[model samples]
Target: MIFIPLWQRLLVALATVAAILLALPNMFYGRVEVANDARASIAQGLTSPELEADAGLWPSWLPSGLINLGLDLRGGAHLLAEVQVSDVYASRMDSLWPVIRDALAADRDTVGFVTREDGPPSELHVRISKPEGAARALEIVRGLARPVASLSGGGSSDIEVRAQNDLLIVNLSEAERAATDDRTVQQALEIVRRRIDEVGTREPTILRQGADRILVQVPGVGSAQEVKDIIGTTAQLTFQPVVQRTSNKDADPGAGNILVPSVDEPGVYYILDRAAVVTGEDLTDAQPTFDQNGRPAVSFRFDPQGARAFGEYTGAHIGEPFAIVLDNEVISAPVIQSAIPGGSGIITGQFTPEESTDLAVLLRAGALPAELTFLEERTIGPELGADSIQAGKNAAYAAAVMVVLFMIASYGVFGAIACVALAINIVMIFASLSLLGATLTLPGIAGIVLTMGQAVDANVLIYERMREELRRGASPVKAVQEGFDKAFSAILDANVTTFIIAAIMFFVGTGTVRGFAVTLAMGVVTTMITGVYVSRVLIALWFARTRPKTIVV
Candidate 1:
């Protein structure tokens, strides 16, 4: 007979009981999900009588986690968006002008007066007031270049400045462009994640695709357009010094200033200073609140550095109008009422409460580095997901009944022990998934059915070995012991090989393939424990109590 130690038997029993308890919450998945959501809402300070009562449904001491249903199961929206990375190049060149101007001005003796010339959006052209000074001007601009900040990019400046005739041509270097592209994609991904998280949507998938695209999926969201509306706005908030306000559309504001049309008033344009006093990056917090006049407004607080800068600027520029620009348009140009030292201020834009709230959320989430163009959008409905779940359930039930009946008919009493172990294996698989917060897809259900067959295969090998030993006239005890000892190697080898395959699929595949691999890999582990160890223990216990001289196969 197999000499199973007392500790091993106790350990198996303990694990089995723990798994069943942990998996019990999944039976009440809807209630647990509601409780979790209500708890999250309470933590966010949004409390209601209904929410509190719902939260009370699941006790705090109990494990309330449920297996997260993926998009195919719960139904939601999917969107693919490509980031306009080239847009950053223009802005980069525009910002480089001041640095170039200051650099060239330092060598006034060698380089004469410099002026920016209109050129292609990708290139910055600087005109040397004196044609002969182009070489010196180019030298000075190139000297300003620093090493690119990237692991793969060696020592190379961000931009390459070369002299072309009387103009200095400047464009982003190859290494610098790669670095900027990576930074832009990462920034866009984070911004999208934050925006989705603010809405309290559960398990939104935001990942970078290729060189310049992002894939976003939000489960339980109604439509793709709704997600777009939330994250589409650039929300490029900037505060600029107002140069002049003009009603004439044809007025020339000259260099170093931009003409932006007013957002609140029609046919009015404001010439604002190109350099911003402060941008949205300086904002620490923002919320939708009522202004002094009880109108919907956005209240914002600035970081420490921003507070000091704003205080100094407002103290010196009292009575001057400051233009608040959003997405390159002047929203309002309010005159400085007084020397306001505090960093907190309210913005009134004649907005509805919904608009105000949305603006505040955008501000808090930060701005996207580049604009995203929607390439594809799709919405999956709950009805389809429900149908899928029903089909999967039927298939699982059919598979389970077949496996159970086959095991009972083939090995009789020993087959019944294997059936008990198979049930525990299923429970353990779900418990492990719940503990790990793994998502379940239709393919994952298929993995479970596949595990059922593999689970019984180990039992078949053991029973066949015992029958062979009995045919050789070996005693019952020796037959059982030899059966388990011989079958152990095959069981271990088969499960190990299956585990390796599942691991490879998980790492190499995406989406549904990964879901399948997760369940399949987990099933292998649970089967090894319940199938080999638990089955052996059951047989050993039966033999200890009933030592039959001849066993019925």
Candidate 2:
């Protein structure tokens, strides 16, 4: 007689129950989501009557993990942004000015008097007093060139220096530019991801596209504009010594100075030094706080090097006005009253509470390396997502109903048993998705429906084998054992091949394809557990109770 051990039956029963419990949260998705958000807020030291009520909606002891819905399923904003990589070239040239100036100054006898000459933003031009000293200036600049910090740029220098008559022209090398482009895109991707995560959105898709573009998909956000507003801020903060205040937007601040408009004051501008005393890159921490007058502001602390430099600069230039610039606009120009040795300072402006909070978030997330120009943007509405969900449910229900009827009509009792295993298989798939925190897209639903149909294949193989065994004059007990044993190899082979393809699809593909692959791969595993083992346990229990001598084929 066929026998499934008591331990095996109990294990299957326990696992099936556990899967059902884990997938239970999805049934009340909205309530559970609210409860989760409330719990998260409470954990962060927040309290409110409404939050407390929401937190009590779900029991803490039960599993609260739910499958994350993908952007296509939940509705969200999608953006394709192209990084302005050329902007970095200008910044690089600007930074190189001080280094080149200092280097040429060290050899004043040979290089003579050096003065920065205005030219293109992407190139630095320094005219020397002595025309014959061009060769020496180029030599000094070339000596300062460092090796590119990338494997592909081995033995290549970061800067290419050449002498154009009396002027020393400097530009970034091609290899260095390529490496910088890659790093800029990667840094932008990470900063964008951090900004989105700060808003507590789930399963956002942030990925690099091509050479200089990024694709961002944030699910459950209000609109594309909202998503853009969150990540679009450059947050380029700098503190520069103020040259003077002016009202003329067309006023040239002469060499080594820039004109920036005021953030709070209309028509007013400040001519500030081109070189900054400290930048946002030196900030270690930032948070929303209030100024001395109880006005909304952002407080920031700097790193050790920045702290030392700021303290020395403030001590040397007491009572002098310094412009706090952000994204080419002056936020405020405050005079230094005392040396700020503590490395902490407040940024005051005509800011609302929400604006202060958002500025804090942006400062904490760090500045984007370069600007992002939105090439494409799309916003999906919740109503559309609801319709998609309903359609997907209808498709799944239809597939399940058709499969159930066909299985019941085909092999009588055995087919009915297979339908039960199929039900368990579906539960296991959802449970796996929940546990993995995977996003389920519309394609994922198609995968589940496909799994339901394929789930009965193993049962069909075993039942057909049993029919052959019965026709060969074997008793029901022997036929049952042989049927399972003979069908195991074929089932294993089929699932193994399908699993390989699914793995390939998962690793190589992105977005929707990956969602489909995840469900398909999970189905393969659950099918094996239910179709072969669970069916055997149920059949064995029936045999032990009924003790049938013969069975219909």
Candidate 3:
């Protein structure tokens, strides 16, 4: 008589039950999603009556994970941005000025008075009073160069120093520039990812497309402009000593000073020191809060180094005014009444509560290394996603119905068993997706439809084998045993080859192609379990209940 081991049968039953449980949440997707969001909010210390009610929609004991929908199946914003990597070169040169000045100052008798001359942003030109000291100036400047900090920039220094006439010219080395460009792009990618994650958007596809481009797809955002608003602001916060406040927009602020317009005052400007006492990079934490006058503001704390620098600057300039500048505009210029320690401060501005919250998020995410210029942007509508989802459902349903009918008509009892296995295979596929938190796209749906047809191939092979055995006058029990035993090898081989192809696609493809590969790969695993093992167990149980002398293959 055909039989299956007790332990094997129990294992299959347990897996089936577990898969069904895992997949149950998807059937109530809307309710489960609301419960998930509410739970997240509650965990973050936010609570209200509506939140409590929503959180109660799903029991805490049940699995809450769901397959995330990809951008093609969920409305969102798409942006293709190119990072201005050259901007960092200018910044690097600007920051190097003080070091170059101080280094050359030690030998002032030879180099004479050093003054910076206007030139390209990427190059720093320092003019000395004595043209004969050019070689000495170049030596001092080159001494400040450090080895490039990248593998590809092996023995190259970060800066190239050379003298032309009475001036010492400094520029970033080519290798160093290449490394900086890569680092700038990578930093921009991570900052964008963190900002999106802070806002709790789900499964955003933020990827570096090329050398200096980033591709961002955010599901559930209203528009591309909204995304740009969140990420495009440089958020370059700086604290600089104010030279003088003036009403003229075009006033020249002399050497080593910049004229910045006030954010809140019309046509008013503040001439501030070029070098900042501290910048946003030193910030360790930031949060949204109200000012003493109950206006929305952001509070920030700094790291140890930043704290020391800030404390020293404030202590030395107790009676001086310092401007809190953000993105090249002065947000406020308050006079220092006393020395402030601890490196903690509040940024007061004309901000609403939402604006303050967004600012806090940006500060906490850290500033982008380079500015981004958006080259292309598009917003997908929810109605389009809804229609695509419906179309996918219709296609899946049609595929399932046709597969079910064909299997039943072909093998009769065996075909019915195959149909049951096919249903279980689908549930297991979805369970795997939910557990792995994979994103499902429109192409992913097509993968599932394709899997339904392939799932029954194992059943067909076994039934045909049984027919061959029966024609040779084999006993009914002998035929059933030999059918499963002989057909497993072919089943394994077919699924294994398909699995290899899926793996290749997953690794080599991008975006929606990977989505298709994910579903197809998951289907291969489920097909082996449900189609081969489960079908055999069901057949064994069927034979045990009613042992027939003769069987129709």
Candidate 4:
């Protein structure tokens, strides 16, 4: 019999009801947030200000924060980023590879290196074919490695250049040492997001494109160039010891070729010649305001230790110019006037309100833990979103009408019952998405329509089997029961496979693929439950009440 245990029956009823309830918010009340120009606001999280276009449509009873359709359904920004983890790693390795090659070549008799095309440990092939002085060669090779302070402390490292038979692996180059960490993808995304947020870009869509790429979509953005700038800037801030002043140093001002840039051009910053004494990482807060003399300036606070260090340094260096450098550009170089005991100080530059705000944002976001460079970028706007939504809707309606008509023709009266269940299934799917906050994409709409067509698969299997049973002269009740019983396993196998594919699509696919996959996966699940179990219950209730011995066609 197609009959389920009472518990199974109750569970189905409850699940079906819950799915409907969950999707209610998205279907009715959820509105896609729009930018001031009624376009998609991709980088919404970046900006603090509200755009003119953010409006919500929701049931009066829904919570104020609860209702809003996502980009998946309403056709908002969609981007696919391919994380180039390997690319970045290779580029870094290439930079240091040459240096290591040169070092080894210099000691050709003792050590020479080669790189494998593909191998584990990302090894470099090495040869100690001729050992003029093996110990000295190894020492020089080791000296090539500098301590990776971020990795740990108090240790010096030489580049991993040693002979294992004919091959020696360079452990990691200076550049590669910075690159070898796991979680590069996550770190890259966070840095990109931080840059976007600093720019006050609104509703930005940032997703991992592949293993190493990032897809970024910024809606309500005026210029893609500006968005690109924000994404690309490294903002590598440093604090350097006030280089010991040499008398007459001001005559040349270009000491040792450390060309300091104008403070206004934060992008032009570079490293100072002297060693760093403190860094932006120690900065607690920064604000754009006037100093004691009332000139355009910035006041910065320091950590407990930085405060002590700064106080001593300023106190000793009174009457000497302290360079306020950012990105290697001297925004301000003011002479120490007095011993400021406090951990805080000010730098007043010829500045504007806009520049001040930008600086403030950058400082607030915190400096990137390491430098970052963009390999790729992708963007989609609201105009495209609207067009996609319309196309999706038309396609959906057409698919639905076609499927509904086909079902009626194929199964006659039983098809009519399935059709009613199909409509319920559609409603339940939407309600479930609305509730779960699932995003719907063009592919997702296709999933819905495809599932709609296949919703009848289980019902068709049962009815066809029943007809065969009836033809074989089985009793009507037994024929109906056996039909469902025999078809259950086949129905399960077919739908389960589709669900697995959908799951993979969601996991491996980012952005739109994920949205579509999720919708498809959910739809397959809903169809099996509603199409098979729900329809059977309603049909059984009908037959039991009527007790028809010979069913009319």
- How many clashes show up per model? 0, 0, 0, 37
> Which pairs clash in the backbone of model 1?
none
lDDT of 3 by residue, 1-553 (tens): 6868899999999999999999999999999999999999999999999999999999999999998988778889999999999999988877898888888888999999988887888999888998888888888888898999999999999999888899888999999999999999999999999998898889999989889999999988889998998889889999999999999888998766789999999889999877788999999999999999999999999999999989999999998899999989999899998777898999999999999998999999999898999999999988888888999999999998998888878788878888988899999999999999999999999999989988888888888888899999999888888888899999899999999999999988888888999999999999999988999888888788888788886
For model 2, how does the per-residue alpha-carbon lDDT over 1-553 read when each residue is reduced to its tens digit?
6877889989999999999999999999999999999999999999999999999999999999999988888999999999999899988988888888899999999979998889898888889999888888888999999999999999999999888889888999999999999999999999999999998889999988899999999889889999999999999999999999999999999887788999899999999888888899889999999999999999999999999989999999999998899889999999999988988899999999999999999999999989999999999988888888999999999998988898888887778889989999999999999989989999999989989977898898999999999999999999999999999999999999989999999999987898899999999999999989999988887788888888874
lDDT of 4 by residue, 1-553 (tens): 2355788768767866765565544443325323222223423544334443343233335422222234533433333444445544433443454565577678665554333332333444434555445565567667777765454423645255665445455555444444444356677688778768765554466876545556776655544555666655545455444443333323333322244554554444333443344556667888887767766666778888878877787788789766677766677666789877787776567767666666666665566543444554344455666687778889988987887788778877778888878877877777666656455567778888888877888788888888888888888778878887888888899999999999899878776687678778878887887777888776776686787786532
TM-scores for the candidates = 0.91, 0.97, 0.96, 0.66
lDDT value, residue 18 of candidate 3: 94
Taking the tens digit of each residue's C-alpha lDDT, what string does model 1 give over 59-130?
A: 888877688777888888899999998888887887788889889988887778887877777788888777
Candidate 1 TM-score, true structure as reference: 0.91
The alpha-carbon root-mean-square deviation between model 3 and the true structure, to one decimal in Å, is 1.8
Model 4's alpha-carbon lDDT is 0.62
Cα displacement (angstroms), candidate 4, residue 273, comes to: 3.3
| C-alpha lDDT values of all predictions | 0.88, 0.91, 0.91, 0.62
The lowest-lDDT stretch of 10 consecutive residues in candidate 4 is 33-42
**In model 2, which regions exceed 4 Å deviation?**
none
Worst 10 residues of 2 by lDDT: 544-553
List ranges where model 1 is wrong by over 4 Å. 1-3, 59-61, 249-256, 301-316, 337-346, 544-547
